[model samples]
Target: MHPDRYHVTLVLAGRPALHGWWGSEPIARAQFTGLVGRYGQPGTRITLVDEETGATLTEWPETS
Candidate 1:
């Protein structure tokens, strides 16, 4: 079992606003997209990461 290997976080004003953990990446990715549409805004950040690999899978307001 993966055991919550995927993490989703929503940050606002440089503080943690929401957090989620899932054992599946697909589910976590879907939640990430939902969070962006629901809470996406200036000074807000949302990210999905694979905790097991320590890799950032995706983030809102993408960086160059």
Candidate 2:
């Protein structure tokens, strides 16, 4: 399995504040939820991306 294939990021005030990488999608998704709950506020953005395919898995405050 590819190591750190899933990338998660938390952006605060238009800057990257936190990030993580996981090989498992499930684990990355679960952590994404936690990050949202813990940092879900105005001006903060949370995202999960699949590094293998460069596809966005999910994001908080999704774009319209």
Candidate whose lDDT is highest: 2
* Regions of model 2 farther than 4 Å from truth: none
Clashing pairs in 2: none
TM-score of model 1 relative to the true fold? 0.95
Write candidate 1's Cα lDDT for 1-64 as tens digits: 5879999999998999999999988889999999999999999999999988899999998988
The global C-alpha lDDT for each of the candidates, from Candidate 1 onward, is 0.94, 0.96
Residue 4's lDDT within candidate 1 is 92
Over 1-64, each residue of candidate 2 has an lDDT whose tens digit, in order, gives: 7999999999999999999999999999999999999999999999999999999999998988
What RMSD does model 1 have? 0.8
What's the number of clashes in each of the models?
0, 0
Candidate 1's displacement at residue 26, Å, is 0.9
Over all chains combined, what TM-score does candidate 2 have?
0.95
